[model samples]
Target: MSEDAGRVPAEPPDLRVGHEERAAAMRALDTHFEAGRLDVTEYGERSGVAGTATHRHELEELFTDLPAPHPEFSPAAGPPAVPEKAPDRHPLGHRHTAMALLPLLAVIGIVLLVVVGGQPAGLAFFPIVFLLAGRFGPRRF
Candidate 1:
């Protein structure tokens, strides 16, 4: 009956939703399912709807019947907080370059001793290097 009566009511704005939002919703759904709040059939149905949901509210609807597990992950909130840590690299792996060169040097020294200092000198060098390598090379135990 008013001047604005001719105008149609505006639809609710479609809040943007992405994989992060959908994944959070899924985690909430999983929590509820694990706690016996939702059955397999219901969980599967809600999970499917969540994965395909476009708006934020559409994803939120999947958890409407369940209680919130955490405030940060509630439907009203966006994505949950996930802390990232840098992977730890092997501490001793870098020393492998130097370790590899040790054997090559020992072989070269033995060859030179045989050519320049004769067989007796080369024979004396072999046992000394062998004992040193066994005693100081990479530990077995």
Candidate 2:
């Protein structure tokens, strides 16, 4: 009789996984979700599982049905490659930041207009900001 017939296979060298490994697995999951391999709920559930996983096998299970992430995207190796420039760069990369300040700008304008112009000219700014936001808001930028 072969003495090794019943021995179990050994685990891979990647036995313990830290936060970075878990995060890399989640990124792969995200890519799959974006490609429509998984629905929202499935993505959320798997993401939660990946986030809490502490072992390599546990993380592997999350992507068992999906292709492995590219080596550049693998967290186990190192941080993912950063683009030379951001994926989407605005004129100054501050369009969104400026857009976010719209409300505050509107409020300040309203206060100034009401105080200086002695009219509700500030209220007029809302429509302009609203239009600007609609034109350059999340949908596009």
Candidate 3:
């Protein structure tokens, strides 16, 4: 009582009890996936990111019936609980200004040099101008 009463547990089994609790959470997740509440892609994705295989395996059991106490539990709680989340991420997708413009820039340069037969002395200068603009373009806030 003299020391801080609310200190983290400092023993191995107590630490393991935390793991057990996480396993319980995994079992809950398994329940969510089994009810068709979660799809294969989502189940796999979430399981892949899980901290332990025991958690991931329980997740698979959601798809296949494996006997357990209470088997799984679903809560009124929002989306299936993911103990971990994907790191800050952007979809690996194309931007219209990207795919649409890069090819055009190349095409125009090609046209000026090949189709136009390189007659214009200024044709070479255009690429340099575009390069400068791309390099130092103002970032729109």
lDDT of 3 by residue, 30-141 (tens): 7767877667897676555443534334444444543433323232234557688766443633453454466457657756775568566645666765675565443364
Q: What is the TM-score of candidate 1?
A: 0.41
Better of 1 and 3 by lDDT: 1
What tens digits encode model 2's per-residue C-alpha lDDT throughout 25-128?
Answer: 87788888888989999999988988887678777677667775621223344456886865555566676777767766766777788888899656667777
Cα miss at 56, model 1 (Å)? 0.7
When summed lDDT is taken over every stretch of 10 residues in candidate 3, the lowest stretch is: 9-18
lDDT of 3: 0.52
Q: How many angstroms is residue 126 displaced in model 3 relative to the true structure, after the best TM-score fit?
A: 99
lDDT of each: 0.72, 0.71, 0.52
Q: Model 2's lDDT to the true fold?
A: 0.71
- Candidate 1 displacement at residue 105 in angstroms: 55
